[model samples]
Target: MRKLASICLVFLIYFACSVMSAEDRTIYQFTVKDSDGADVSLEKYRGKVVLIVNVASACGLTDSNYKQLKELLDTYHERGLEIAAFPCNQFGGQEPGCDADIKNFIADKYKFDPDLYSKINVNGADAAPLYQFLKKEQGGTLIDAIKWNFTKFLVNREGRVVERFAPTTAPKDIVKYIEKLL
Candidate 1:
């Protein structure tokens, strides 16, 4: 009876640990809206290194970041680097336009087109599930809340969030890491 109880206890412990460590969803499991409000399945990017960024049109870091992002995309896009840009107005209302306006603004200003998604809240109760997943995967300085626009998450080809970058981290600075993943 003692040995049987010990075995049962060990099984329970193992079951609890496995349940606790299991992930409910992966990056590829999410389906987000694009600038056109169409459902875009992240599974399309499963085999590529993905760089997910919370973007804004009027943020102070917008110009530099956009330029560098354009450069990075132009350089490595054909080499398996996929940039997923999600516009957000959660930071200072910097991105107050509707989807069409935001799309036009990006086109006129940057002349660079990325896989831009629909505007989303990166913080607070209404934050998008994708952002929530990302924050949970790699908690920021504030843990699960995006501090500002341009905060980036680097995802491996396997759809796991591998690294988190602060809003101030430049796209050029992230090139080495992306290269290593590629």
Candidate 2:
């Protein structure tokens, strides 16, 4: 009876641990809305190095981040680098426009087109599920809450969040990491 109880305890422990891992949260497990409000499954990006960024059109960092992000995409797209830009207005209400306005702003002003997702709250109670998972996987420098626009998360081809970058981290600075993963 003692041995049977011990085995049962061990099994319970293993099961608990597995459950605590959010069922192995992978990027492929999420489906998010795009700029057009269409359901897009992240599974489509499986096997590609993905850079997930919480973006804003009116942020101070917008200009440089957009330009450099475009450069990175132009350079490594064929090599399996995919940038998933999620517009969020959680910081200072920087991204206040509707989806179409945001898209047109980026393309016309920055001369760059991105895989734009629907505007989402990247922090607080109403945070998107994908952002919640990302914060859980890699809480940033001081807090899990994203500090500002352009906070980036790097996910490898295996759908694992490998690194988190602060909003201030330039897109160019992340090239080496992307190259290594690719």
For model 1, residues 13-130, the per-residue Cα lDDT tens digits are 9987668542434698799999999999999998899999999999999999999999999999999998999999988999999999999988898998999999998888899999
Q: Given candidate 1, what's the lDDT at residue 108?
A: 94
**Cand. 2 TM to true fold:** 0.88
lDDT of each: 0.91, 0.92
Please give the clash total of every predicted structure, in order. Answer: 0, 0
Q: All candidates' TM-scores?
A: 0.87, 0.88
**lDDT at position 15, candidate 1:** 88
User: What does candidate 2 score in Cα RMSD to the true structure?
Assistant: 4.9
lDDT of 2 by residue, 103-149 (tens): 99989998887789999998899999999999989997767898889
Candidate number of the best lDDT: 2
With a 3 Å backbone cut-off (N, CA, C), the pairs that clash in candidate 1 are none
Give the total clashing residue pairs for model 2. 0
Candidate 2, run of 10 with poorest lDDT: 16-25
